[model samples]
Target: MAAAQGVRGCLLRGPLRARLGRGCSSGAPVRQQQQQALVAAPAPAQELPSTRRKGFLTEHAAPFSAFLTDNFGRQHNYLRISLTEKCNLRCQYCMPEEGVQLTPKSELLTTQEIITLARLFVKEGVDKIRLTGGEPLIRPDVVDIVAQLYKLEGLQTIAVTTNGINLARLLPRLKEAGLDAINISLDTLVPAKFEFIVRRKGFHKVMEGINKAVELGYNPVKVNCVVMRGLNEDELLDFVALTKNQPLDVRFIEYMPFDGNKWNFKKMVSYKEMLDTVRQRWPDLEKLPCEASSTAKAYKVPDFQGQISFITSMSEHFCGSCNRLRITADGNLKVCLFGNSEVSLRDHLRSGASEDKLVQIIGEAVGRKKKQHAGMFNISQMKNRPMILIGG
Candidate 1:
């Protein structure tokens, strides 16, 4: 009642499709000019032309509808942008309490660059974009970015994933800028535990943000909780209770390993363990069919007003249906969340690579997407930036 809320892609290759319009010469200046033009003028929304070549995805194809498709036949319409690597809180699982080193402000992608790349993806068939960050709300220009992205022709959804600290202040402007949904990360129900996990004294602020989000009619406002052994695992039931009255989606994620988190297998609270715990408390809990491309396995408590989902990225891999891509704050594209490979769109953009070249680079990278990530057994060998740097 008192303590709630809070805490916390790829490339491909290809020839320039005709409908994509206005191919540019290969060079940094020419590409920058073309990117500038795109930012200046977003194409009007319309059906994309059919692309039926044996190696390409057909227009409007359900799963592989995007202009870029991987070897596994996954269409990627969801794009996650990391606005910055600088965060306010030092979550135990995300980064060091002392803070990790960050890229210089000059090197991070500019709002214009983000818009340019976002337009390219939307043109290529991305319909959904999520703004993420060390703390997206911390970036003063985030609302403007969201407003610009909403004007893109084919983009149907704009969302943000935040720690909910600044959401109270930013939600109205973001909502006005065409934001569609929000996912707030609040790992524990206890203020002391929240302070312990996040290494900050912002629990009340986060709760206020959550309450504001609900008040503002952010339908299906999601609360993301990362459950770990010997830590917040005891709060699983407490989180589920959140959905009983409010139209929230309380997602419990398995504790995952990344660089500098001191991760170990013993710390993971498996999805099965979580589901069982919920069932024991609510024998009538119902499983809900989830979107094929969604990472979570969804459920609802009988007569509950909201839902619960489990992002079993570690214990249960959903790679076959994974449809999301990530662009780091500095402009590298990550096709797979757990993968180490990144194609630098920022470098290419600044170097003056043509839009067609950028498309080709993206396609080639997506082509190399693995069928699945190396699981728990090889978890130690997987190299990745800390979760904060990688974006939530």
Candidate 2:
């Protein structure tokens, strides 16, 4: 994640976007002066994570002088910024039946405010940033935001996780704005199933957008499928077949508990179960090499064009090597996805806190990070935001 901002001309990014494919290239000029950015930001701020080892990720576990680094000697170089909490789809697994209460517009970060925080994190040690939300594309200024983030000198990869409801139309503009990686959420292929899962009518639009992403040369377009026990477990083979002919990375995520997701142990699917199920069909699935900080366990078929992986968040937590940080749409810094504790960076910033003060706030919150999140059973009982509100 410490890799710097030189991944242009179809260059592959760090562990954040591990799918195999050539990424889009862009060289647009930056206009940082136009925005109300942090004029008093740390001077001589690093363009990359470590000035000692520039333009490359610090592969070893050695500690660096990054503010994002916690006490456990983990350096967080990947930042997930929630663009908004408003999603176009209401997937049964992501949201509760009653739905999440939306954060007020006045409390949310403006485009300029988001840019400020992004700049701050990059200046600290963040090299890769993934824009997430209920649906980031729904934001009218998403393309502009992408363009601005691309302009950051030392930031390496710019990625987004969307439902693909509006990707087909804005993909060209987004690609031109320097988006290096993308993960589209598609839990079901059947149109009726899609509608049932999301409680919406954009199944065709989502499929069209996926095809468009593949057509537009986003190599190894990642398709995120949240696997549930009775709902979509039977479709695992169908998802694996997708990788046979295309550079698609179908990641089967384990169903997890959120505030309203009605998570139960019975609904959860373990990584071993999914792998065993696949091995039954092929009997020759190959494990792929990945970085230590990677959350997904990647694998592929013998001669398939694509690969598959599993996010073992429930059965097997990857907190020991976690190098990621999350910022809610409302500007709260969440050190862990399963942790409900948060520090309002928005509050500090709005109160006219200086750059040094902001660093102290961020460091304090990061310092309070637990060695690992609570167990699945305990986490289900804890109160936390729904997945949609927290940014998928």
Candidate 3:
């Protein structure tokens, strides 16, 4: 019986030895042989907790034996996590109506869950995290979530994109929570026109929020404007005027299709048109070098207090340089803003998946990412999911 046991062990060692070649040897010291055997064997597959895997597809199955997907070959390092699906205002381009299918409060990720996921993402080489939402500030505990995310090891910067309705109330807390910067969505400077576009009379509130954000030392507070033809397009110069005395970085975004908005082809604002308009006003506008993951082609005017950026999503798509992966309010991982498909992380997390398993799932999801988004403002093949449901 002992001879038979020895034979079985020898058979196992034979295959491992062949695989390792000269790197492993059975004739080595007993301690060294044992070490090689341990290295040859894969880590034991432990089942994820039942509670954690509850919502996952493989709940009844044994824990996944192989977790890592393709190595970080397709390195998309930016992540955008939507905190909520409820916004205060209904911008004509963002949301046409007030009542949309908001994700139930219970379905949203808890602050703890968000922090855990952020840590996991950072560990997997994600360097930047941006908090977005229907309005990120609308989420009551956004500050706490941001604070928790700050504790992550590998994250380099954290930003929030908000509607600015609640910025005044949340700015201090957000800064305290280690928020690096903010992007406030402001389409028009005229109060009545702003009310017309956003369908809200709280323009002053948003402006106040921007002012308060500046006061709290948030540098480069960006003002995002969706330049739509014949709508608030006439307010182009007025929007530019915002940069005169303030440190605001005003960005003009070409309207894209997603929501049930009145997105007509003719109404689309091209990057060329926006550049021409800006140059006609300020010919001294010069191009500025931007960070690797920045979607916008940033520019600065000579002796100006602030800068301007053009996001040519409609005219000159930046999908090639796109490094963002969006996590929806309910935990669906989206690889592209234009794609309809999603990888359900909520299901996996609810299932008792281990951190390593979750990382593999994410890597798999990202591996299948499309090479580019749908062509410039091509809405025919667009997904029915609204932008609010997708993080900005």
Best-fitting candidate, measured by lDDT? 2
Model 1, 55-132: lDDT tens per residue? 233322322223455655566767999999988888999996668889998899999999999988877767668899
Cα lDDT tens digits, model 2, 1-392, are 12222111122222221223225521111222211121111211123323433322233322222356555555677789999998888899888888788999999999999999988877665667899998999999999999999877556678888899999999999999888778989898788888889999898888888888888887778889999888989999999998999888899999999988889899888999999999999899999976566788999999998899899999999888787899999999999999999999999999999986887678667757777889989999998999987885
Task: Give the lowest summed-lDDT range of ten residues in model 1.
Answer: 1-10
Residue clash pairs of candidate 2: 87-134
In model 3, what are the clashing residue pairs, if there are any? 48-352, 52-350, 52-351, 52-352, 53-350, 53-351, 53-352, 54-350, 54-351, 56-347
Residues 1-392, model 3: lDDT tens digits:
12112222222211111112211111121233433332222122223333432222122111111121111122355679999888888888777575578777778777777877777776554556889988888888888888888766545567889989988988888777777768889988888888888888889999999899778766667889999898877877777777877787899999887767767878888878888888899998899976443578888888878878899877777665566788898889888788887987887888889975786677566656665666854554566588888877
**What overall lDDT goes with each candidate model?**
0.76, 0.77, 0.69
Model 1 regions lying over 4 Å from their true place = 1-67
Shift in Å, residue 249, candidate 1: 0.3
TM-scores for every candidate against the unseen true structure: 0.85, 0.85, 0.80
- For model 3, the superposed segments whose C-alpha errors exceed 4 Å read 1-74
- Summed backbone clashes in each candidate are 18, 1, 10
| Every candidate's CA RMSD | 11.6, 8.9, 14.1
